[model samples]
Target: MLDTQGRNEPDTLNSDTPEQDLPALDIPKHERRVQTVIQDLPVETLCGRISRGALILQPEFQRNFVWNSTKASRLIESLLLNIPIPVVYVAEAAGGKQDVVDGQQRLTSISAFVAGTFPGPSGQKRDFKLSGLQVLNELNGKRFSDLDSATQNLILEATLRVIVIKAESHPDVKFEVFERLNLGAEKLNDQELRNCVYRGRYNTLLAQISQYKPFLDIQGLSAPHNRMADRQLILRFFALQRLTHLHYRGNMKQVMNRELEDHRDPSDAALKHLEELFTRSIDMAWAVFGPRAFRRYQPGTATQPDGMWEERLNFALWDTLLYTFSFYQKSDIIPNADRIYEEFLDVMTYDATFAEYVTSTGDKADRVRYRADTWRRRMDAVVGPPRSDSRTFSRKLKKALFEADSSCAICSQQIQTLDDAEVDHIVHYWRGGQTIPENARLTHRYCNRARGGRED
Candidate 1:
């Protein structure tokens, strides 16, 4: 977890200790270097600035324009009614350009209305029409161009209060201001925040990698998505890989943020290396696991039908397996592809403790360690150990057999000895029974045969 020094330390999972023991954040006070100027500019002036590229309505940090025409209309109605709106914040950029840090939705709405068009998804722009107005009922259903000269003049003359952060401010100070202003507003996920705070070649590379067809297919996602979930997963993979390479042990969130901040401005060679690594790793995963690459697989039993393998990607499994595979040479992987696939399933099915660690422990540091360490060990064993680890009975099945005194489950008769007793699937395999221990029962060889291969 993150420590007082902003570094990660290996975490111990103690059930007795509460997980709420978070390290205190140490924020130092610094001299004020950021200067801000507040001014009320006429809507016409703002629109002119936007048209001239002096105002940046969409920054890398801003989410998509989500307001429907009705919501946009409501803002216009409020403006017409002389109701006060919240102040918009902007960061001053070079060449007299201003990046909209907050109030993007409001500014975009105004800009679209003034331009006589609303921005649509995928770069399609549509005509803007006012609707759902309360006080300005007469103005409802009218386009900006349809308004009379006096009405247009009133709107153009309306002023909006804006606060602009000077260009001379430190980037960190600007990030701090942006974070504080939007903390309670429409919340941007951590990845979205990172994209804004760390905008450079490395961040651009992440976006490009996220759109790669193989990467999207493995993730079960499509390109040009808005929610940023896919980007976050990509970031997660890169962050964990970096941590593992550096042998760093800390909080996942802190590690991700720090890594992005450090690598914001990567060299061309570094970006190319990362791109190749990500592409090759994803391709290998798809080739080996097929569509079920990062899904959870549960061994089925009699009480429950074998839980079919899931199609959804499991983040825990993805991080561990991806990082492990990225370490191997192509020569090592291509020849042993089948062996690696079989070993992965065997590890997932036989290693109960590792499965539990991945499924149960949320994103705790210890859980991350458990998964990575277990996968590493399993990968190493693939080329060395015997293909199968012996057909071992599960603990549950063994306990049941011992309690039954070697009684045949089919006939309920006692068997002579362990050698004569065979473990049978209560629900036959052909009938969709899972090969889990819970589905197994002790039975004599003859009784098992007499029962045939019929479903129970």
Candidate 2:
């Protein structure tokens, strides 16, 4: 999801996914719920709802309140002057709670001003004083508290016509309406919509995993902000894994929806297992490639030996590497970290199959398949076929292999001592070689590492 310049900065909450995965414009009328109601709420009553939790301002639905003192003062000026403000829109959530769909900045500005705390100097909240009034210069330097009783009553009783879309509305319908109505800078992307629509244990897991240090370090993003872009990426990883067996809908949103529905309320045991895999894969990814993880590269020349590293995060590459790494624990991948990294670079550089078409048609299942399968086969070659076998053979097997053969099976060299000797798999552990004594041999640890495993 990086640009050509390789500057995939996560400073904003907006996702860089090229596709818009929201529902279609023409949904069936029978499935739609677009009822709405209007309430003329006074400023004081509305602010009290915010205080008592009857109203909610979800960050995922909009951007942070960024109005300055001058702008806020203008709003207060309008209230004092009785100028009709713009209509506010809200969605009726469960428990009769209203979520602000639009007008967050205006609402927050009113709330902040009435509370005597406006966004002031040095990013700190301080008592708001009326300033920068073009026509109301006479009212300058007056806080809300400084107002006379009649003026205070006017400010508190200022009417705001709020249109609340009822809770019966479908999520996609709500999302569709909000897309048009929302005038905020941070529009709800797919994941943000999912975060709003699917509030459950699995969604909570996505938020949790996105903050993981290795995951954040690799992504170069600090946390899940207003848009929940990182949360989307986290969802992609787990969702795609589930889709490995399920039918593939080419549409990404449908794919994500299925995944969320499948595990909306996962058991503690299930969450624990998935979490282990996520953390382990992330740890292995960071350990193996470091900053180069999920980045692209150009093939190297004979002189260069290793090609140039392109600092970009390709989502397709991210899917392949992270998903493949998830199958094994960190202990499985850590031993051959250097080898894995170098060989992976070579694959990206020399092999066109793995490197090509990562952007244009990358989301296709076949494209994901060959790339992941290639890397996985390479892993099997390097770290051995995943037979749940431990690297450490028992002491009895080590001694028996040593006693059975005084010479190393790999190099046919004489064993010096057991301290320097290591149990090497004869058939190569990577090639489905088991840990049985028949397949065991003694060799110098140096020889084993440098050049040991063989095929018969």
Candidate 1 lDDT over residue span 1-456, tens digit each? 112221212221111112463322223356345679999998999999999989988866567898999999889887888888899988776567888878889989988998999898878998899988888889888989999998888788889999988876655555557667766776554556656656567777877787888777775555634545566667777888877834645445556666776787788899888888888788768777877788878877689866568655676787788888777644345556788888877777889988886566346667678778777777787644322322335656665685767777778878876667777766655334456777788888788778775421
With candidate 1 superimposed using the best TM-score fit, by how many Å does residue 426's alpha carbon deviate from the native?
A: 52
On a 0 to 1 TM-score scale, where does candidate 1 land against the true structure? 0.67
The clash count for each model shown is: 2, 1
Minimal lDDT window, size 10, model 1 = 8-17
Best by lDDT: 2
- What lDDT, from 0 to 1, does candidate 1 have? 0.71
Query: Per-residue lDDT for 305-389 in model 2, tens only?
Result: 6667666566777778888887775556776899998888778777787778554442555666777788888888888765476
Name the candidate that leads on TM-score. 2
TM-score on alpha carbons, each prediction: 0.67, 0.71
